[model samples]
Target: MSEPPRRNDDALTLLAVLTDDASRAQVATITGELGDRLLLATTIEEALAHAAREPIDLALVDVGIDGGAGLALVHHIPALRHDARVVAVAHRADLAHGADALAVGADALHLLPLAGDTVASTLAAARSRRLDARERHALAAALAAAHTTRRLYDRAMSALAAGEVSSAAGLFLEGLVAGGLAEGLALYTALGGAAVRVAAIGSLSAAPEEAAALEALARPGGIDGAYAPLRRDGSLVGALLVSGARATSTSILDLATLIATEYAAQRRARAAMTNIDDVGPALTTEEAFLAANEHEIARARRHCRRLTALVLRGCGESSALAVRRELRSSDLVARLGPDELVLLLPETDTLGAATCRRRLERRLRGLARDEGRGPLLVTSGAATFPHAGDSLAALLRAARARATAGAPYVALDRAVHALPLGELVPTLARGTLAHFPSVAPLDVPFPGLLALAEQLCVEAQRAGLATYLATDHPGRNLRAPARSLSARDARDAAPTPEAGQRDVRPDRRAASAQGSSVELRGVAHLAGCADLLVIVLRGEHASWAASGRLANDRFVGVHTHDPRLADLLAERLEEGHRRRNPESSP
Candidate 1:
């Protein structure tokens, strides 16, 4: 039976790849039939180059046109040109003949010498009716992209509304990363009240001086107009500064600031309302495979199990550090922000993890000591793998939400509508966070750290660590925290985890406890245009307690009572829940 007709709403801009003059003319003739949507490419490379610059909704490749060059173009078109869909066009029904094109990457097949009218008609019909088997395909991709963006935005806002800063930051950063803007972007903001570069993606290795120049780009009324008005309730917060020339305009900065402000506001609102804890992220459960061969990718698959994801944002750094330190000291963790975090809960679904999140958040709020501003704010989202989706990118996108712009949202799942994802979409492999479970350590010790005369942990070099050791360590580390590393990047010295390949999940295996532990995490001098320590708890009681009081002059430390266990717990907490929700015990 012939396939049904393609639809009109498909809105695909077709790239017709053909070498034969007659075929090209025929397809050309029918271009108008499909809204003159065809863009002819005699060669594959030209088609790809065209696609890179503009949107090509669909690609039609002539299978017998050349030395598999047409087929090759089909494969590359879908990849390089994300918005471009692909299909194989040939004279016969022998799919085997078109198998190569299909094998590499072909979304649909078409028998050749078909009337140009017929081709256009088929594509048109496909676009209109979901019931037609031969319908060329649906606008699944566009819908998905839009949906993912929306879902991510909503969850982000939920996290933001809840005042989960880093979690919201993580959700937002994911957008920059997926949009391919990371490599050239810089995330600058007010950690508490002072301005600082919170996170950065991309390479500035050779352009340190150039990168340094953009630092001032976030200044108020100093050529950086975007950040000039980042005030909520008459208070100026920090700005998100971008590096490189692509987004170097005041407009871009304006857009960035708008996004950041919306995000910040949503976060503040979410936190004030919930007062109850929140939760989710990915999973981690391959204990056996991890134990057998930590680095053996294939083997780990067998030992892994199911896990969910919890993202917490908007609480900003101080609270996020406390939460991450608290959770990692006890459970699974991944740091998504100086203030945001993700939790990979093994053996639990998103809903289950959310339950735990609620309880935990409630307890955390209970622990809140009033500073008069309000209970710390936090927003959150949850997503699962395989069941939710097979691609890490897709899953994160689908279940996450951003509160920065578009319509306001409260939760992730609420923002997304998972309709049928029709054919023509990319193949997604089921990968696990198991490969890169936790973040690399941001575990930097204070320079020349020593026991001060006052018995506080102080920087031996400047006596600052000693003061910082007193419950508050302020003066942002001009350097990135030591634990600020990628997954594998963080585990250079980790013993092969006893987790299995199948056990690949987020923070499933907690460090074996040696004894009681305590953990503290926070940013310092956040008010008065400086960073502030939110919490300081850990096995190293004296150190953490001391750090809390030395705010702005010292870096906060979260520790437990047991030295070794304390170290393990404290260090682990820093990596949990995307480095947002830290915890400890004593």
Candidate 2:
């Protein structure tokens, strides 16, 4: 015989409040018809206490009990349990309080002479409300996940921009974890017809056949787990294997695609670094060091000798020469930049590399003292072949990553937060924006336009200027009035008899003074009051050029595609300020 179906642990629990014996019997009959587990409560306090202890899916309050005390308790049911749906019950004589009960908080009203059909319909409405609540919570959770993924993706891109591939991989893994994968994340690369696991969060205990299958699969698919292949220029570089249920989520798929694309880009960049020798023969070029260092690694591999790549920073030629005097002729030294150098030590393992690093640090310290220069900060990293890494790019990345994470041998105290606002803000601006009127890309999902508008106001405050954020987005959400246009609401913002100049004020009775902060439908209110104006235009909609005529003298047009909108606007205002004062330098 076939086994009976299993019951779901998530069955709904209902609370029924009825004082009279007949009323209690009727509620029991109704709950039995609905097929929900009923918890009987004789008083309001009893129902409330039960709700506080456990999740209450539905609450049925009898209004005839204790002279309408049950009607009043309906309001408190939802407060005790947000997801609980309440239905107020009233007898024929007490039906007057049905509407009032619903007005307070009840989801619906169930009148007396309750039949099986009426009870079924009322419970159905309660079920619908429960579904709506669940959907609302799900949407909120998805949005929060999207926001977290976006933040991590941005950080990973920043690391990739700096050519820190290993660091980027680490950041990408962090994003994956934040996106909900608990464990069993691994990155595997194909080397010499075999797949090798490069980085992993947990043990990659898959058998040889399973590993080979993972490497062979072109698309993301799995029976026991999932693996997304990382491809570069049509050729497979590696694959990212993830286990568990979260691996099948839309967010994980998106993250996997992003990582694969970035990996391809990084690989292409590494390939280009191999060709940079054609540009110049200068030893100071980092590309030159990277290009020439591979041969040294290959020779060491052939000879079965240890090859160490040491990355050095914050030292000069004299200091390098001092270290060179301490090295053998077999060791290869290449200057990467003014304050950077890559040293290839033949037959030297991690221990020998550490010894050399210590001697260099000591020599640099003495040199700093003799030259009266603040102690020469020497930050270094070492990666040895066939031990720390197998490939040139990998070895270089490992060493560079170490150098960044490790401390400067001499103190420099270059913390950005320690700087004064006057000095710090300009430095940040310089780092973030290379030129003025920077064109940034915008991405608006529904109410995103409003968020962008508010960001503009914040930027204006930072620049100490009264600003107006104008958008030609004709969507109803954009029709909010401008707030704090000037010191007086009468100036410029007051509705005038002039055509095309009348203030487009929001209904004051319907909106607060801060309503303008939420929306800026028209520019008529801030015509002359705002010193700087930021105009947001949708790429698919009417642009600033097509939006009637100019309302502000100093304005910058920003599209959703444009990034760093606030920075661009601030830069524009500074440029205008500089132009106004011919002798001032911005």
Candidate 3:
């Protein structure tokens, strides 16, 4: 019996991995009669190569090929082509051979002197099974996509319900991007008579002004690429701008409407709350402070602004009042405990917070003297956003730790230890290079420092850590030449290379050849020590800094795990760079 010929699209492609001439000829004849394609492979490599290039519907394996190696190919065929069926062809019907074939993922076992009718029936059944498997696989993918979409929606809604409108917008944009609805999205709220972007995700090239103009002109009915207007009670409250080939304007519009409604309700509720004025300057309640802190943190993250959280212990009402008076009206002051106060300073980096702490300490000391009290010991600690910590809890914990320790910088200085340049370079590079950003001594005459710095830069780039390299020797190349170096040359050049340092040189070459994302800034001069090299790495989860000044071939500067120290050094380096190159872009 002969099977009917299949149409062009329905035709199956069969792979026959056989050493037997008879079996190969039989497979070719069967495929020819069935109107299907047959690929002949004598080795496993050839069969895999054929499957890699094109789809294979079924595979026939000669169990005796290469002394049983062909059986292993049956396991791999299905992996390469998910729906490909395998049949083991044995010289004779042996129970052991049949069991071995079935154990290795063969769909069926066929004995030599194969019948054409049996082969045709097996091919038809395999085709049916392949089609069913493909359908099931597609259905599973669709279900997974739907589940992901629903999860993202629930998370965004939860943020919205928590009164975090900016966070909600960010979460929603992330969800849309994750769900393939948009490549980029920006959420704009009507603020101070213009559309202001509150949150953004992915690659959006539209300028703030352009986004605002687009929001102003956006209408209810627009194309998939156009802005979606957010309206509440017929009044336009905000807008959503999405960019991508897969952008769904209708879904975005509905989400915008829901967000706008919730936002309007929140605004009305806030307006209805009664405002109370205190007779004297006082700290804000912890609850109110936390709420405001969260809002400020969200704004800071959105705008790429800096924020500082300071914790001061051993402060009385008089000292608290002094702190409140010393701070700007925009700063937030709240009592965290009976004698501890927390201050939120927006647009403040570590250095700014340190300066504020010094000023406040002086004011408190004078107040204590005037009140005829003993020397007031007010210990304070400060942590900056995107540096010391990203969240309130993290920032508070860092700040509290610093306050408990005497002076922040003094404590950091105490932690610093002197080490040989050879030892220090590898120690810093190998240990916590990824966990913390680093600052190294760059002014050292040692050539190894430059190589180590370059190696660290490459490692940081590979690890996805944002790196900043500053040096007084701007003329020196930070990266090694893009060529293979001998083991002796590497050792002589670096003295103490990091573990697997040789393996990562290719990454360095690629990074340099590709134009590394690591920021390199050269100043004509550096404050403190011209030989000082500062390596700072900033990451979402952690920050690290190592600043070393070479003295008598020894690195004798501070290295701290404290992110504030790293941030402070980074800020100073940036400031120095700006002073040296006034017109250059940062």
Quantify all predictions' global Cα lDDT against the true fold: 0.42, 0.54, 0.62
User: What is candidate 1's lDDT per residue for 100-122, written digit by digit as tens?
Assistant: 77777776677776566656765
Q: What lDDT would candidate 2 get against the real structure?
A: 0.54
> Which stretches of model 3 miss by more than 4 angstroms?
1-13, 18-37, 42-57, 64-84, 90-96, 111-164, 203-224, 243-255, 258-586
The numbered model that scores best in TM-score is 2
- Better-scoring candidate (TM-score), 1 or 3: 3
Q: Compare candidates 2 and 3 on TM-score and give the better one.
A: 2
Model 3 global lDDT (CA atoms, 0 to 1): 0.62
Better of 2 and 3 by lDDT: 3
Q: Candidate 1 or 3, higher lDDT? A: 3
lDDT of 2 by residue, 1-586 (tens): 1112222443456787766566566656766655666778888788878888868888878866777777777777788887788888888778777777878877777766566676667667767777777889889887887678678777666554433445556666666666665455666655545554544554333523235634564344442346677655677766776765364555554545545444444444445455542213455566555555555565456446566788888667677777666665445566666667777765555545654665566577677778888645777888877777887677778888888865631232233313432333333334433332333433334344445544544443333223343433344334342233232223334232223211222212111122122224232233332322234321111111101122232122234223223323333333344444557651
Can you tell me which runs of candidate 1 are displaced by over 4 Å?
Answer: 1-11, 20-26, 33-36, 93-95, 121-586
TM-scores for the candidates: 0.24, 0.44, 0.40
Which tens-of-lDDT digit does each residue in 1-586 have in candidate 3?
1234454766888888877777677777878877887788888788889889878889887776676777777788889888788898877634466569898778888887567776788788877886787789888876776678778777676566434565666667777777777777776666545666666677653525323443554656532345667776787777777777465667667776666545544443343222211113444455555654566676567556677899988788888888878776446677767788888776566545655775686688789889988566677888888878888888999999988765444433223223323334344434433423343323444465555555544454444323354444455454242111222223333223323211222212112112223455554364444566566654323455666655665444545546555555555566567777888532
